[model samples]
Target: MSPWTMPLVSAAVLLLTGAVLVALWLWVNRQSWTDQEKRTLAQLEVVKVASGIALGGGGLFTLYLAARRQRTQEEAQADINADAEARRITELYTKAVQQLGDDKAPVRLGGLYALERLGQQQPDQRQTIVNVLCAYLRMPYTPPPERAARSAKGVHRPLLRNSGRRAGIRRPEGQSPAAGLVDAQQERDVRLTAQRILVAHLKRGGESWGELDINLDGAVLIDFRVSDGLFRAATFRGATFIGDMYFLGIFTGFVSFAGASFVDEANFGGTFRGVTRFSEVFFGGEVAFSGVSFAGYVTSFAGASFAADAIFGETEFVGRTHFRDSAFSGRAGFASAWVGESAIEPGSSWPAGWTVSGEATSRPGRDGHDGQWFRLVRTSSAAPPRPPTARS
Candidate 1:
């Protein structure tokens, strides 16, 4: 800081102290004051009015000091923010280098999170951020083994939080535990900061770690809906099936699919909204769904593998999808599906679908889908107009 800045800061401190003292004194003097009260002492006639003048002057001086102090504090806050931003930028770059080199997916995810935190003060960095997230989304999501009977044990296996250190937050401004306590509003700010960090880390593809393992007891998270969401490699490995899981364009850092195998089906019925790459994608977890829904595209799976019961009973596909040499096991079901035929597909495929009335015995996967599933159901051109053969 400049010499001038130090002095201004010190002056601000002194003024703040003086203002506080003055406030205390004034409060004390007003202690006995009330609506029906007055200076009724018998010594009033003999009192010196100069004393009152002195008090009033002190008040004016206090006001001046307070105003000056406020100005300095504002300056200090700006300085703090600038310093924080600078340090964060430096850390972000350092982490980014480490992320690129580190073998674990989480570290790279951390780097992505750090970049986002840095971007808070640098909004124009949005495009740069897009690359980071996109890289993750392009990875892969694969399944593993097959289980005779499916259970919910591996339905949800959460990944690690890829949040960086800056996820920490300061208490609400102007809230002093000694004088002003932060209320819900203040705490909310802190809460939101943490949430942003978590969300951002997930976006950067930090959740999928090739070196680590995931274990979700039984969670079929199709929408990436749960934050701090968990998953299981065993379930994914035993995944005979996996229902529609969509990102809807959200950024993701990590999503564990370790030792997870698919038996019946797997589906990404939406758009890959942002960076969501994950390494070590495996499917051995048996999963079953009658239908699935997704609003955005899907992406990312590095070293992810899949095994059994693969079924896509009825799933919708809306964007570009690629499963670069990914594997699947057992009946990769794509029966009675109604996906949007690519604009290039024969225009006669407007599939009207339905949701599974009961827990779908299998997840749906198909070419053109519209978020619906049907059992023992079929579509026809009105049975060939009833063949009007009789001419009745």
Candidate 2:
């Protein structure tokens, strides 16, 4: 049972066996001995039994000491192995980070892959590796302009869009004038690779990092799409989505896109379970929130501007919703949407002539429903004035 119990029992059995052997020898020589010899033989038998027990105990002690030494050596070896592994991970991490600073785009891409492989092999380093990728995307970058075609006269015109400093041609420190120009197209490719590395490990299925928090504040993403994924506490505040952006996933904690700008089609169809904010966000293209559920403490779209058609079809808002001073340049649709426990704050913009039904407010919490429900209804056909396009 206990660790000491077996050893103690074995020691007792060994000592008893030694005593029995000594007694049997004395009994066999009893008839062949005189009275004087009998006395001498009894004394010798006592000494023999004592010596045998002492020897047996000494052997057990030696065995225990050997076992203890072996255990200590194994523990020390394990410690050494652990230290060696830590050093290896540190070396690999340092080398990969250095690779990211290379001037060549191919070298930077290799660094990104190296970091991804490292994260996959070491789960404890995944969050740190993701932060590195996010930091890379946050670096100063200008998207490449559309390729210009040659004129009919066989002359190439100077590209005006994204010209000068915005064209990513700024000189770096200690660089020659001839090598000062940075290739925007090459930098775009490197940034795209970093974004891909983040997304590849965040989705469901093969080698996915489970529900990690992401903070991409002020980062620029190109043609980003995250579908059927789960996240905890994601932040994209002040970030810029250069192309079509899709956030069709689930957020279990705080999510913010405050002051963000979506340049192309922005679609969001997911569930937000914490405080969700889109305050002052600018949507430059068609925006949709089809079948989305906001079940957080607050869902704010205060001062947000939509340049194209905005749709909220079959969407459910289960918390406090704010649309204060939001401007939509195109048609705003709220078809089949439900709002729960939301107050119509002053200066809040809604769909034209939309009214909240009082009867629907009292019907929730009945029939196993969640909260107070508010159904939106249209009372007039007057459309809101369309605002001017936000982009220059």
Candidate 3:
């Protein structure tokens, strides 16, 4: 009940109780009193009852009003405090983002840490901060000039500079890193730190792992390691890996690497639970997918080029695995690779020149090299004398 209503009701009850008492007294004394005496007793009774009821009711009403006023004041103060806190958080966020564009590497690192703290404190800002870090990584970056000169033609160029043995960061004014003069080693350190931040937070059951998607298109990852990691939907389209790229023991959401280039040896020995696309990707070094499993709805490698040996030993495909129009300059191996029931329909997306020799189980060749796999195995001729093996 409302404060005002309770006091008013109490007053009404008091008045009624006084009236009832007066009536009872009059009825009891009617037989032993004269009319004047009865009138005097009734008048005195009414005065006394009225005074008591007035005082009690007025006191209760006053108390209720006071309490209501105090509560209102407290609520108003709480709102003001909340507004001030929100403004403080906003100011902090703005300052951190501004520091990300500073020329000094140390300042940029500080900004990254500040944003990370903000995300940890505020769950709603975690994904946004992660996106900012990814954006920084995606900025046009290349290896040092000395390393770039050693790379082959059409490779992703390197642009980051190095001051000394220690690393730093350089994000000049504007969005692009083209005009930014970066120390190669220092820039690599900053990028590594940024990657570490994401890795630390994106783990399962982590305090800051939200349902977020990672997009690192056109990023330059020199010698990074994402092995044994768990990620949500992610895309590294058009990204370049300068050194050995290890994707072993990784469990990921829908993944994509369309047009990505791996300069050195690449290992994809992991399990992909969602769609895995690698269309138009170029593998410059030896690629090993041994013991890899693709349970995704669709796994495609259309138009991919393998300049070195491509190994798929013991790889299992639980769903569609496509390799249409793919080129392998070196020997390709798919020995002991199984096609589960979900992907029984073989040769659906194979190259036109390749053929499947076994309907159910493919046997190894005389030298234990050539094995008839489920669908796609590209040999120089229609059926070569000696085909590649698991060890090839």
Local accuracy of candidate 2 as per-residue lDDT tens digits, 63-146: 877898899999999999999999999998888999899988888888999999999999999989988888888776766554
Q: If ranked by TM-score, best first, what sequence of candidates would result? A: 2, 3, 1
Give the per-residue lDDT of model 3 (tens digit) for 100-150: 888777888898899889988988777788889999999987656644433
Better of 1 and 3 by TM-score: 3
- How far residue 268's Cα lies from its native spot in candidate 3, in Å, is 2.6
Off by over 4 Å in 3: 1-78, 146-182, 205-211, 248-252, 351-392
Per-residue lDDT of 7 in model 1: 63
Candidate 2 lDDT trough over 10 residues, lowest sum: 148-157
State each model's CA lDDT, in order.
0.39, 0.77, 0.72
Total backbone clashes of model 2? 0
In candidate 3, how many Å is residue 322 off? 1.1
TM-score per prediction, in order, is 0.30, 0.78, 0.68
Q: Kindly indicate the candidate among 2 and 3 with the higher TM-score.
A: 2
Q: Which is the winner by TM-score between candidate 1 and candidate 2?
A: 2
Local lDDT at 158 for model 1: 46
